[model samples]
Target: MSSTILPVSELTPSAAASEAEDSGGKHPFLVALGQRVRDIRARRGMSRKALALATDVSERHLANLEYGVGNASVLVLLQVAVALKCSLAELLGDPTTQSPEWLMIREMLENRDEATLRRAREAIGELLGSGSAKASARSRRGSRVALIGLRGAGKTTLGSMLAEDLGFPFVELSREIEKFAGCTISEIQGLYGQNAYRRYERRAIEEAIQIYPEAIIATPGGLVSDPASFNLLLGHCTTVWLRALPEDHMARVAAQGDMRPMAGNKEAMDDLKTILAGRAAFYSKAEFQLDTSRQPLQPTFLALREMVRNALQMDQTEHAE
Candidate 1:
């Protein structure tokens, strides 16, 4: 599906300026975090209202937070953090990582150094291909590759690639609902509002799972904004995070099409960062994180494949034992 881009004239002056002022801003991070929050919420099938009820925060505030607004106070932030079962530091962006193996591998991949990428791929391939390597039972038991990241993090693009390469069917949760309703997502939002859209999305996801249990599914970046649906997803599948920089997300989304998020909203970038600050805790819950910034399609795909292979093999070994 094509991305929607809003023109400069349509964007609120403040929103445009915010985008411009953010030098390597927090939009991408916020997008990822928001997605994670939404996914967790959706998999739980909890509505925004439900989250509000649990956190004692207003629905509008929740919406604003999800949209990447800057109104979230420390108190409100703590409430959300507690409700989501996470620590404050994690939600506030923990920068003191000791550099995990995956991060190093991802860095190597992002370097665009052919030798390093090839070696990484070969090493992964050999590890998986070894005779003593475990068989892939996770694939048989039905693993889910739910895409989590800010909008325009190539979740859809990478999802399609994953489904095709893995020989599984691909389903975009948002697109499925749009197709089912016979209307664009924006239209649905305008007509029924976020709650109603979630209702439709919930149905679409349930139906999709029943129809194709083992498939690659590309959920809307914001699906996790609603708790009920997010929980449902978590119960049904394994999730992966498509990590990227905020600027990258804005650029990609802008290039693809819809600028509505940035339009007429002067605080768009700041709002994005704020949202990410709240949601990072949730997204960090995912099983794997795939950093796609500056990483090409081929190596990223290979890395994902390797991750899936490892997961499957682990599952198989568990079953065998």
Candidate 2:
């Protein structure tokens, strides 16, 4: 087709004024062109699929063009115009001749009413001024993380691997807990019950934060069962849940000869499932999650490392802004 030209004389002063007002008193012909193409396709009652087949482009590609979310190559645009049975200028209602969405968006932005701008500013301030503002600020300063998961999820094994790879110190929270409690973990749990064991767990974490401050901490799996304690941990560090199916967890723990959960509980297997189900929601709340089930130890550790790296990068970017 010959190059399509939009006639300036065909446009009304009011329509021209509207376009100018919308486009910051300037021409946004490309954006206008995109909207016009979409309008033409819609007017013909042709679906994106029909246009795609006729133009030999994918339907998704055509939709992206219509939405103006992606740039259409020169050849693609020409093919589309031909399929629509219209010249390029006709398809793109020329601002010298048509109205466009970006022109409208720009107009809204630049010519925004006084009240609207005020509200927008207020919202921005509130979002950046809250307690999370400090957390976000710290997020930029560094990309240190601590991995917290259940016993059989390979805390010590994975912690050493992660620390070596990331060049950070690897500290086991359980070991710290044992020292703080001044008793073996089993002794604490047996004498004081789960509650007292958790107290010792909290104390160990507090001391670790104060001392190490920037190490990869491997916390006990049962941490989330205590919300108050876990929230405290979350505030001090970025938390990731290393997750696996209950059966996988059970197998790993059993392989270690620590069958406390399975010992004479008749409903031992059922109890395990119940505990896993109960903690499912809490685990799901983690900032990042990794499924370790059926994955080799090395690959699972690698996946966890990448996720931490990505999360740290995201935190840095957010904090910098």
Candidate 3:
């Protein structure tokens, strides 16, 4: 059985709105939803017929959905989202749209001074049981430490050392993401797009948290770009920013036999500098900051060991209290 294809003209926002109006005051939300579905399906390069087959919906019904004339059930929407390999939220609204929790927070902060609002937000988060706040508190009582920095900042090396010294598991988050995606990070980005990569990154973090309650995590450099996943990291792990000069970062990568940093690129160092500058604000949010630039590896290792030891001691004290 062949499915009906929606005409380009019928898929337009104006046409969708008219169709909604003609349907006896059916809400315009269906039009928006249909558009969203069509856009995502197109982006994923899935044909409507393929999607319909995967989602167990008729192609004719799917055409009506794309034309913003069908009233799709929640179950149908969910199945479509599953077929498209996205969250229901992603299908229903923009990914960056502020959630209800954020809206409530904005309203609560109205007319408040910065300092007062900060304190009030903390208190309210604790009172209303904010997941990030609660996770942060739990992190202080647990044994998870995440190292954040640019590539070649010694996160993997130092994290492995610290984990071995402390008798805890060491996890590289990017590797976990690749494992979950059943491919390399590069492959994931190439095959699924950056948004999908971010989704996998979040899922990898969540799984790591569950699998290794007491572990050292070495995170990807761009992990901070995703606010939700970064917040989850900040809330659940004692983060340390491993700092280094751009020149040193370049030198280290070259030393590791990965000339990709400078290969065929005269402006690689400049690009590194720009990236570091852009991410400095986010990296500075870590509870601990350690500079590993222009120092011997052994001395840097010693300093990192001391920092981790102190942090663990502090965590123990907080738990005891």
Best by TM-score: 3
Per-residue alpha-carbon lDDT of candidate 1 for residues 1-321, written as tens digits (9 for 90 to 100): 111221212223355346535734536445434444554455455677777889998877776665455546789878877886544554454442122464355555764865565455435534654211113313333655677777877888888988988888888888899987889898999997988788889898788767876778888877778766765565556678888777777778878887866775657777777776777766765668888886787888888888876875666567667
* Pairs with steric clashes in candidate 3: none
Model 3 lDDT at residue 315: 75
Candidate 1: where are CA atoms >4 Å away?
Answer: 1-141, 262-266
lDDT of 3 by residue, 106-206 (tens): 55676897568556744654665543353346643277899999998999988998899889999999998988999999899999999999999999888
Query: Model 3 misses residue 18 by how many Å?
Result: 6.0
TM-score of each: 0.55, 0.55, 0.65
Show pairs that collide, candidate 2: 94-97, 94-98, 150-221
Q: Candidate 2: RMSD over Cα atoms?
A: 19.1
Q: Compared with the true structure, what per-residue lDDT tens digits does model 2 show for residues 1-321?
A: 112222223334455456646755544444455556656776666767778889999877776565345577889988998998766656556443254564454455566875575454334434654211234425422444666666666677777888888888787888888888888988999988998998888888777767764578888878888866665565556678777776777788888888786676558768777877787776665567777785899889888888888877777777667
Q: Model 2 residue 47 lDDT?
A: 67
Q: Rank the candidates by lDDT, best first.
A: 3, 2, 1
Worst 10 residues of 1 by lDDT: 1-10
* Candidate 2 CA-lDDT value: 0.68
Model 2 misplaced regions, further than 4 Å: 1-142
